[model samples]
Target: MNSGLSKRKAFLQSQKNQGHRITFGFAGIADFRSFIGQEYIAGMLKAASDYDLNFINFAGAIKYSFFDDIDFIARYFKTFRFMKKPLIDGLVTWTSSFCELTDVKRVEDTFNSIKPLPMVDIGYLDLPGIPSVRIDNEYSISILMKHLVIDHKYRKFAFIGSETSSPHLERLKCYGQELQKYGIQELENSVFLLKEMNSADIAAAVNKMLSCHDIRDKKEIHCIVTPSDLIASSVIEELDKHGISVPKDVAVTGFNNQYSGVFARSPVTTMNLEYFKRGYAAVELLIDRIMAPKEHFDTLLVPTSLLIRQSCGCFEQSILEAAEAISNSEEPAFSLSTKEDFRPFILEKLRQIFPNLNKNKLLTLADSIFDDIQGQKKESEILRYFQSLLQDLRKEGLFVNSEVQQKLTLLRKTILSFLPDPQKNQMENIFHQLRILASVFIEYDTIAPREDSYLMNTLSQIAINFASAKSGRQIQDVLRYQLGEMGIPGIILSLSENMTSDLGSTSLELILPEPPADIQKKLPFKITDPAFIPKFFFPQGRRYSFMVEILHHEDKYFGFTFLEIGNPNISIYDTVRTLLSNALNTVYLREGRSKKRTMLLTGEELKGILNLSEDDSSEVHNGLKASEITGYLLEHLSEMTDLDKMARELSVSKSHLVRRAKELTGYTIQTMHEKLKIEQAKKLLQVESLKLGEIASRLGFQNQNYFSSVFKKNTGMSPRAWAKRYLH
Candidate 1:
């Protein structure tokens, strides 16, 4: 048997002893780094890895340019389904994002293979009776419709959407349904659906709607609703080229609001689908499925948000009034309103803008805004009231999220609407200040992802370096370069030597800012608790934080990684920590494997061992010939006693085989046969249970005495006596 086979057997044997373990498989149509997989899979896996769990990620290959997109996808799924096994506790899949109804059968087939086990589907489409975590897109679309009808008061609207997928079309269908809800049914002139998602196709749809007589001439088409912010952006841009200004000429709304919506010329009104929460929920539901398998599968529709921006005619009258009121530069002309008057108005607008806000929080914010305005405070103080209110809403916990940046933009504008009117220059001045605050909010949103991008790129490079690493130093270089370039400069990496329950006097494996030549000992921290409590050491005067995470490979701990933390770039920190543990384990295990390997040599004491050297011990120069010939002989020894037959088995000529055999060992085929038989007999000689006649028959000797004579020639001892010498 081969060493690779032996290693595989050992691995399988060890797996049998690993008590109960949970391993998850994340499968998606797109590759891990692609748009879809990053949102739905990697984030949860990164979080899960810190705990005692195993994650196996399956995604399409990046560099298979030889195959077309269709071909590659088919092959990707073909391999992805077969990769499933009993070991994978659950699967988190996104099938219909990149694939649609056409591939549903294969997706169903794949899911069925993992049936009876938990499967959490976060796809656009899911199989019947499987727990599906999907965005409640209907509610998101309904918010846009309600905003258009009640707030902007635009009943007639054009819908521009593409059949990108059925779910995407379902969102578009909501537009007509929403318009009809307002008693407007003749939507033929205002609806344009595109076959392709390309800009040319979208532009054609816009032109087709403009060409319609009902829509062409100032018909009450208040806004154009699009299925995606990307399409909304294109529609707005195309409409711009035709001299139609958003909110000035018409309003526009988009779904799945993205950066395109936030930064469009007249920032678009869109939806926030809560990207991370969806992934986290998927895993949570899958875990629940395991813990309680009898629970009915549910289609969990998460909360959604409608972000009102300038494009959808949000805060239109407020802006004009604010500008007019500020130009006068005097305080006057306030609403003769009591707390009751202001309270309902403020709460209603806030509830519309931030639908997700708790009622208590909304009441608190409304009271603050009301108190400031009723007091007739100075404009700056008044602006701070609103500013502080916006600031309070942005506290990290109230779902201040990736998409909430747009809500902040819209919310500040909504605040301007409730300001005391005709307080000349006061409203406009406050609005301008609000713009500045919004810019700061925007800047905060912008800087975070830039840091994330830098971290992702750097971490990707570090991963590449770690994969090709030949030694532990190369692994350390990855961290050194990462810390020096992107991470904090002042840091120490104290790598633990042992992974036992106790770290056993942790030594600093690599420390930055090398000590002077005279200092022989760069000290290691004595952290008694293996949990790595942060209080152990602090660099004096620097407010550096630390996290001690156990470095593990599967279930085995390799070491603990101590990180100097400050304003975390989360993805980078997680990647480096995970790669560090994996790298150290790789280095440690490779060296251990090399140390543990025993030398297999030809000897009477171990003649039957696989890889036992079948060569003259003294002849080192002819190693390759003996090694190659021994391999062929090991498998075919029972069949190759004759020169012709041996040559035929080896695919060599009889003359060539005999000549090589003699040149290497000074033996004919017949003599070599006797020698091989005697060697085999000696190997079995230690087994006293085999009678001498039985051993002779097994070795193909004529009789027991003949087998003994051949064995004696090889080992200078008779078979029974040889067996007695070892077995006794």
Candidate 2:
């Protein structure tokens, strides 16, 4: 063995003996600007940071609907293969997002492959061993339904969503249960199960629902309840085209208080999932599970709240609602909320405002001011007293302009109620002068920074750099230069041997912080080796963290890249992976002549999505190149059979190869291999000349009966019937 290899092994073993810090892996298809990605990732990262924990965020854009091409799915999802034990102590994944890649069971089976490694789902995937921290969808939907039915008094209603979503189904069930409580049956046209939840499909569903009744008719649907805010916004626009206005003509409500709903034309009435808290809770749960391996953990249902807005026909703003908004203030001072049966609401708000100040002192201040006003103290004396209070607040460093204004307003209102009609105008004059005096002491910022514009410009430059690179070396050069600019200290580039799915060995093409001369020669090593990356890559006796992402395009499986998680902005990590993936695919096409090159979307497509001005960008639609690459992957994989044989031919361990297969197709290597065989079997069965026995033997099936049984299990039909139906 090479000396570099021996040292690398030794370094890793030594670190292991010392019992290094626990590392958690967070995997997500991070479209960072999107609702779930932004909120959940932010909360998770915040918790990890606060606890001083090490986390590896395996991020990529691997949505199946983003590309029509089959190969892209295979390449995009290979990022998940890096979620192995020893590298990471526990896995925290957004499994609901995985439903965008393939079936739920496939995702389940793939995660199940990594058993005994404590895993927590951040999204709604309810597998047996893995506990999920998800929004209480049933409770959220019930709250929404009650608002629509009882508050808005909507008798006739409709529910719409993509047929494939598990959450959507759960919502539909809740919608049904809610309707049943009111003694109303779900009418035939009242439900819209769309083929997909994009704008076109949702709009078409809306049109179908509206076909039976004119806008003026009494039978028109009162409200359209959607599973997402994005869909509800689309439905609102579609209604407008036909001369129907939201709330005025028909009320509309949506779930998930995303920007799409918050910034909608009418500002959609929806549910706040509080995903940030859920994300924090998920990390806490995973850590507990990791610490106590034998302890049983149950699913955590994070409570969601209703966000009432104009679209729901509830224009009257409740005092409690207004207070809640103030409680979630973005100001540096404490939030304001009231206790149900404690002191006065205003007193509670005051207590939170000045926590350091004694409660008795606050009450005494209020009592003294009120007592003087009631005693008919001179107006000038009262004015002087108020000014002194403002000065004291400033001295105490409690002069948040808004909170100060709240205190002044509360005092002014109370004083006015105590004074006579003539004295009220004098009191207002005194308060007006105090406001002017307060402004003199406080410096208020009038202009907010244009961070959005600056971010867009920076991303544009980075995207152009990646897009222009034409070769593997050029791509690596771009990565080397841009790493520092993206706030990343260094990166480790690894490539699968021969750019194939074979995981036996990987070439460590580049490490940003070059190793010392003795260990530098071991450029690539077999994955089965003790250490995939040398211990010298990390700082000695210091806290360290790193992230890994897959590098591939279409059906061409390259490898994965490892880097220190130096950048706190999760979006930057995702964006970098995208640029790296696209650039690598371009290089692969240039070098390999036998393979057909698949075109990837330009950086402009990314710019389009990031363009916050484009409201319609929130809606998924056809012709959108939000995907990575295009071509066939399964069409190629279908030719292979026998997981053990495939592993042997590739000269890799079966378990390692199986993980690659699972990451690619969300199935075990053997299961996916069988699925591939069945796909081939279907084609052969379509041919009239081929006998069932001949087709079975040709596709590597054990026997005719076994092939038939497998075929039936997969396709829900026997081979004879399937052939009879399709045969010409």
Candidate 3:
């Protein structure tokens, strides 16, 4: 029975042991506090929890003094040791930069002294029994060099790195080895080791390199290999500030394929080291080692790959070659094929002559050329011919003069014209080919002819003739013939300038008798007012004025027009004056009593009637006519006595005199004082708060009651009400 109990107890103990959990601590979490890091940490925790493991994460920021603080490291290590358990699985230390100041011996010593249960270093340190996961700096640097040499064909190279890191050391070693393989000497002076390079420091370093007499004299420094993409971008910026161009003056290659490199002025060519995968794999390896400490330790080497971009000027050639091959092939393959079989051979040949050609654009051009040649000739024969031509061109070199562009343009036009139904397609394919070629070979410029040329004149004349015809059917006929001659099948005239400024009021106008069916489907603007003009002007503040008259004759409509060009404000005044003068001339030309002229008829007559001389006639005409007319009437008030009776006798409305009086004298005609019996009546009524009956009696009213009622009706109030409100 005791033996049976012992077996049961042992079984229970085994179950408890199986339930045991391992905890992990992550150091320097602050350094890895980005979106990528957060995701990685979450994954790490999930994995640990699944494996019945516990984790204790640590974050020690090395922002300022903490960078060189040995005490901080010692204290953190002590705390970790205290928290560690006898059954602790293992510890992993993750850091971005190297931890050891001196050598691997110092790193090992530091680890042994700490004695944090069982620990591992996962950064840039080689601890004795600890497993590590780090970037394959040597392989990555080699890949970078290959991109620079084989891809970009850059010879003069400079490397930027941090001196206090294992990655830099490994990268330097590999960089030297690769240079030796290419029969190039690795110069010590070319390598720039920055302790903590900021913008100013980076700029200074780049300027020094660029200004160095030896480097400038030897050959143009074509490429710079950097340890970090961020550093490489900074170098590009600095070079630009100094008036030096990237990829043009110097190409740049960087390690660590970062997103920033993609968005930089020149996208950098970088190595993809699989940083996150490396970290995860490192954790898994460290955990396994902890579970079985006596197990044989192993190191994992992650492979690196290249992401080529403008900075290195490498991948463009490959794209060009692929395009060329596709173009030249008889039966063009659609599926992606092997890089070797589909390499950009045409681009490679082109680069032999145009060494500075951008790889991406070159590849695009080659593809276009390939498409152009496809199905046009025997594949084998064309290939042979292309090869021989490329060889000859390379020997002669690409010497593109102005005539070359013109010839290319002519060739493109000819080819487009020969295509099946060229008008229908507009030779879109041919245009694309020409554009690609121009973009690669020519500097930035507009290939289309300017608008002020003979071509534009011909187009304008054709459009004008079509618009001016009387019959809609006639207009269409004229347009079809004219446009067909010019090789234009269809055109929609949206807007046009009728005449040049300085044409004055004699502008040519185009009238569309029958607008296209499509235009009828769209919304229309105001088209009715006879005097309404469509304004046209030059860009540099020259105003051109014109009015269009739509003529309807039979079933056709034509545009009749006149234009005036001058200063806007001046022209408006001049136009009004001209109309008034013409009216006056018409009145003078009339010869009958039925003409029924007034004293205020002529501008000159009105000026004389106002007693103003001829010198002021223009000012009187341009100024308010109503004021001058009122002044003339006031001057002739005695002659025009009995205004109400005179107004009726003159055949003018009473309201007309009131309105004209207000406009000229700034008062109603009733308010005008004529020094008559009404003035004496008003003076007698100006007593303080006088009763209406008393005021009426004093004003010599025949009946006080009738006078009070008349006064009240005229003033819109009783005398008492007015006196109460306004009397002092």
Candidate 4:
């Protein structure tokens, strides 16, 4: 076996013996800066952290012009070659991201090359054997259709979305199924599936929908359903321009409760396809596969919720009304009309909102509320208990004022109904007091959004800082300066000259706030850990949640950046990633120029040592002629470390080449190679300004220490001492 492969196996074995976490690889063809990308990555990180395992995300995009070049795409895709056994134990592929650029068969083929590692597909495409974790588009569409048809009494409906998206197509099929179920025949012209989603295409679709007035019904379409919220909002705007009022002239609904749906002018009625649940379910499925390789698993279906709002021709459910419904369910657990049965009902309702809330704590809370309702607890004591519970939930980042008010209101209304007729008036006054207290608590305790101008200014400053970075160190400085404002707790930066070609030599460049001293010593470390993070780097108590994102510009694979994401606004992370990649590329180019100059000078100096003229440049030779062995030795210093390979390349016996090189250069072949490397190092130190570690790397030394030892052995001084004396 090759030395590098042997070393990697040994390293992995050692890590395994130390009982390291099982590492899972997540591959996605999406830029992390996008809304979908950010949510998926964040969800995966959260889920993995909960399991106390490891997740390494390998992400890139092929949709944009910058990533259009074939060579660049090839190189970027090559980064996935590292997602194999001994590096990651299981895999999750975001297949949906492949819909536009490629198909499922191609994606399966790409991953099949690295098999025996269990895999999970997180997308719409159903790979034959690989279990998929995706949102139930059919169920979500059915819910929306039922609400629109049965509740709103909308008879005719039109559909709008892109043809490229799998989920959209699935939703379209379900929409047709629902129409048939309701006995409302859809017109052929009503289904407008575009090649792509753009303003012009959507405008054209809207025009076509309006012009088609069915003579059978003699009525315009009652509603339009779309696969995406953005498209739905655009349709609403276009319809309005033609004097059609939403839910009046023509109602509209959208899929995915994205910001465009929630904050759209008309507030689109849509389905909330919770991406976090998608991410969490994906990891669970992947882990199950890893643990039971021979067992078959079904495709995991993540649930979605239908959100009612104005665009659907209906008013949104108010907090009070929602509370009333929860308190009046016919189901046994939710028949919360008496104190004797309220505990289970309250706990169940809260559990739906906070799934991870402690069961014992929830029971205690239920009892406390019951005590207050029975008049066994003082008013001040009841208020204190509510305040404490709310405060704890707030710190956990789980408190939402509207949701909290809804739950509290449900509790209040249920207790008033259970009281005797004579006590009803007295109990209603107590409930009124509780309502006032909740309002005051919510007003004072709600987390406020950060100032818009401050965020904008901070982002602007971050961009400027990145633009000004001229070196890797300067880029690190920029991160240190801006991580706090950006809400990133820590960062680990690794860099490679060419990640696909030289992954084994990729350097762990920096770790923020510094890891422990032992971990710090592992800098300039290769990716020997299966997790792609050094073991023990994250303490068990810390619960560090992070995602690994590629650092590259198109085909130029620089390295990976592992970011700790705590901020809800993910746009900033994408901005930082873009600027950082550009900055690193700029530094890479700068270093390339310096290396060219240094290599040129070293080549000339090597010829002088061999007593050869410039016209006899070693690069000009095709083969290692007997007399030109010294030239060959100097030309191929880096590859000469593998003697057997070198001999095969030269079409000569190893012993003969070694004897010939010694005869020509008056030193052994290996010794001559070392001498030449030292000569190049001396010139680089004297003529150029570079770090010792960089000089070592440029000369192909294993590390700075080995380079120093070789230099000292041949030069009678350390490299630093020689540089200090000669440069001056």
Candidate 5:
């Protein structure tokens, strides 16, 4: 059995063991610099590696491109020679140029010289003795021509050849043979060889072909076929520069069903080579060869199918016909049509634009649009309707861009113009402009369009503000900016010092205003106990003052407004209540609702819910009070006087210490103590030679066990886990 096959089989069998591990090696002529080759091979190898099947590419040792120097080739093989016996379960080659064997004789001679390793050629497998997976290039190209000639009735064809590669050679030959069977002669001059031609060279070639006297006079080329869609696109660009439109003037077809080709202004009708699946299959075949060394080395030729689109003039007639019908309609013009009539038409047009759209999503979008526009008059009235429609379109997996939007807008306008109208033509025009503008707004509003880095920055800013000293102001500022970015209204958070005054008391009472009615009704609000406390005695019928009010600016609702701490006292109860109140008020204001009734919780009420004793002197009830505990913990944490230790020393359970500390200091004892420990650990880790186990042991673990467990639990993972994952 070949070494390559032996290695792959070992790898696969190891994977089945649930604990077995193995690595497969991939060898190619080109260096691992080309994005296409690198990405494809990397993806396959990574998958194999993830499945406990290790994959190593020979890319580091051998250049991806064909080696002209004999020394380079010798070094490449020599690198492999040093690898242990059965180094690769299977050797997978992408292009024939990468391997030592250029022919059958080379295959036998080379493997005979080296230790036996199974080899699988991806495309160029001349040796029937080796396993391979390749596309039926000849058959695929012939099918493409047959479709053009028989179905599309396209004749006077031209061929674009990638003369440097074998696949192109086979395609060109098959194209000529197929055309000949139909009593067609492929003119020698009609064939253009694109060998290392840049954009300018390609453009020149296109110009020459178009300007050819014989071709021009005789109209010899009605349709041109290229070996790849990228080349077809270049041809299209060149022809477009000469004002010769594709499909309309000279129909064009290309191979490789790339999405880029379909998204081209004129979608290209190309062959679906199923590259992803082919890559997947290749790996599977390589794995198979590794496991079964004696199995016959078979060539597996994958089939290709055509994906017809506008580039080949396939859907041109339907689109033109639809456009003409709309232009000729007798209905009064409007900007948007009734959802009932508009959705189906839009769906049809969109299907033409993107053939891959799911039928279910198309129907769902139509339903959503209909629901949105049921009785809405103004376009903005159904703003959510349009938003929902856009979402549905997204679910279809069609790339929505400016161009798609423009086309959709036009289609919507046409449909709306046909629907019944009051002002008729004038209303239609006005609504049309509004719908376009609204679509643009909605497009920009989509979070999907933003890059990850920008979103991360926004989130980081929010987190920083939430943790700031002047958190109330910071929160308001952050919310304001976020709302603006979201195109919502502005908000303000106010702190009223005189809202609550009780000279003898350690707690302050504050009042928060009700949110707008629209916002309030649409949203629910709840005040937590920690942020608000009933501390000041209120005179009968006297309204208590609060610190926050969420507002709306320009008909848009801003986010939660927070109240600043007053001079009287900022307690855990106050912070919790205030945050909860602010959150509720923000939601209400955004929903445009009025405050119904202010709900207040007394110290007794909070104590009952918290299951705390009324005489618990250590209990802190406000965030301000919590800060005192945090400060104490920070100061005494390294003295073996940690919160938990203190709790144990004081003959109290850790839970009791946490509750009492939170009530008295406004911060959780656990939170404060954890921060202190982490700080100390960082300092110790930086200076000490202690192993993680020793460090954990020193941290007061029963052994290193509890210390490492707590360290990781507080942080993210265990101390040893973290060290192994990130320290190095």
Candidate 6:
């Protein structure tokens, strides 16, 4: 905040009885679930300043349906419930997201009740009750049109955009107005709006455009205009598929100059709408109106700049060039102050750059920037400080000549505000302050996507490691090394023995950051147990950990990954679990399941289940090791039909046998016996002499229908169907 606001806050603090606490309701899409919409957050924060804020986070346009009255009513009611808070004094909202997809009459009642809360809308003006801060589409589009007509001498063009609502219509209208002024009328087939927001939609639109026009002819459509860089990049990609070079075959330009526009092989020349300024202005307008209710509402217009890039045939041009030139262009003959003087000053400067940023978060950002400077001299460090601030500022808006002047004025006013008393001569110091900040910052920004190759490589390496993992110890070592390479400090892999069915009693099978002593003990529990969940928030440490079920092909191959506990990057964690799940699936299919058949029971239960006779010896009480038990079963495989006699011979319970079998092998004893019997039945089913009744009797089923039902349930087909399909 500027010194004026600081002074006002100080004064307000002193007036305890007046209750100067201001709560500004910021309504828009800052919800992390709608990750694509966070571009609004930067602008919202700048305009919000130091006020106590409440974010409604309503993405009604994207979340709610337009036609269903019941859906509209329920969601609108739920979203607007924030308005019921008695202390909310004013509202700043993205009207386009609010009004476009919702019934105005349904939402009208909510706004009407809060008519006294001075409100300002951003992005669109469709909402009737509130004043808005919008992009100057006519002025913005006119710049591009004039540039194309005069400088490039282009004639025919196509406008590609959505026809959704007011904002979209405004851009289209601006295009028409510019064409009218130049005496260039659009051809009947020049407009393209596929009414979808995907790259495929834009590709289809471009294909349709090409089908109608002959790009080979010089008089045909020479350029494609779009609503956003996303559409423009998609159109370029689609055009590339058809072997058409951008600007060579058809020039392309887009609005919003967003990061997604970088995919265009030829960079898209786009319009910068200064969304931060718009966001700031909306808050200011709302605050001003709240302080003093005006007889009339005002619409604030934030300016837009044209970025000349490769797609419009401007290969030599750059991003934010003017702001950058001033950074190094001017050699400051004088410095501000000493190290002590600069540190506090630098801290305050960042507060302005990241206005409305959380206090702790703002401090954290300052620490990072300061660390980069590393105690340099005030002269160079202050310039670095100003350069960083300007770079952040340019993200909000392209600082052109006029926009630069507005910024200078803001700094000058702020400087004058907090002075207890000052002479006119202090104007020189203020000018010096403005000059330092006026310097531009130029640096190439890199967007290293996380959903790129590094993640894929990490998964591939993990799978390769798992393939070579012959034992439990190797599985641990492979996992630790593989995940560590991906900057993952911690991991926990949970897999149930019986993954072929529903994962009920699964637990933390493997966990890092522990004593090796804990690894030997079994920690199996139900999946519903709290121990399965890892902690999510740990601000004191850089490390994080999250656990997600690994689902590959089916829940049968289920597991979970916990990485860097308490990390906020949910997207990365989600992707890692999925990759791990897939890698595990690949390894499982290649090497097959662990092939373990150890009875999951105590020594007593295994002995009781086996019903071993006196002649079996005292060693019968030994644990049900997979090798020992499977070897014994193979030895006496044929004489195991007399269940009661076997129980009587060893004085072991029959129920214990059934329970132990399922727990260890993921099958009931009866089912295990049935599986063995099915192998015999398959041989009999193929025999020309053995009837269906004889087959059922041989499998220990008294009725043929009972055998058929069990066969269908277990094998997903009747005995006849199974025999016909597999035998043939």
By lDDT, who's the top model here?
4
- Model 1 score (lDDT): 0.59
Clashing pairs in 2: none
Give the C-alpha miss distance for residue 110 in model 5, angstroms.
Answer: 8.8
- The digit string of per-residue lDDT tens for model 3 on 1-728 reads 46633543354345347643344555432232122343344445554544434444443323222123444443333233222333134566654332532344434543443343455555665655666666666777777777677865777778877776567667877888889888886655688877765777677778778666233322656678887777888988887787667777777777776655755788788887665566556556666565556776656676778777777765434344434543454532233234343335455644654455577755654554444434344333323433343344435765343434444443333333323443315434444444344433332121112111224456456545644554434544664466344433232221111211111111122223333354343312221111112222111122112211122122112222222212111122112222222222223234221222221123444344334444533433223345444443433322323456435433466666656555544555544423221333343344332355544543335566766565566667665565556555
lDDT of 6 by residue, 1-728 (tens): 78746754454345323633444555553223333334454455544434433222233322311122333324333334333233345777764554545666534544554455677877564555688888888889999898888888888888888766456678889899889899998888999876776877778888898889876433587888887888888888888889888888888998886765644688789988776677667766766666557656767777889888778876432223423433434332323344454357556765774465567655654553344334333343334544565676667765454455544444334333332233223443434554534521221222223123234566566657666665545666776666666656666565645444332233456666542453325344223221213222111122121333333333344444445423232244444544455555555555566342211222343344344333333333424433243232322222334555433323456665445444555555555555555554555565443467756754557688987887777778888987887668
The CA lDDT at 141 in model 1 is 82
Winner by TM-score? 4
Candidate 4 per-residue lDDT over residues 427-479, each given as its tens digit:
55665566556555554442122112125678778878898988788999998
Could you tell which candidate, 2 or 6, scores higher by TM-score? 2
Error of 4 at 283 (Å): 0.8
User: lDDT rank, highest first?
Assistant: 4, 2, 1, 6, 5, 3
Judged by whole-model lDDT over C-alpha atoms, candidate 6 comes out at 0.55
Of candidate 2, the 10-residue stretch with the lowest lDDT total is 624-633
Q: Cα RMSD (Å) per model?
A: 17.3, 17.2, 35.0, 13.6, 25.9, 22.7
lDDT of 5 at 568: 16
lDDT of each: 0.59, 0.64, 0.46, 0.68, 0.51, 0.55
Better of 1 and 2 by TM-score: 2
Ranking by TM-score: 4, 2, 1, 6, 5, 3
The clash count for each model shown is: 3, 0, 11, 0, 75, 9
For residues 1-728, write the lDDT of model 5, one tens digit per residue: 77755665566566656533444555555432223343445446445644445444443323322223334444344234322233245556654654443544443444433224666666564754566777888779878888888987877887776677677788888888888889887766788887764677677678778766233322667788888777788888877777778777788888876534654656688888755456556777766766677888668888978788777768633344445655676655434556666666667755765465579756664564454345445443334444655566567755456555555545454445545554345434544454455445544443232211123454344444444424334444555444343222322232221122111011121222324454335222221111122112111122111222222222222222323212111121122223333443444444444422111223443344334455554444432243344444433432344555455434457776677676563546655455456544544454223366544443334566666666777787766555555455
Q: Considering summed lDDT, which 10 consecutive residues are worst modelled in model 5?
A: 498-507
Candidates 3 and 5, the one with greater TM-score: 5
**Residue 396 deviation, candidate 6, in Å?**
24
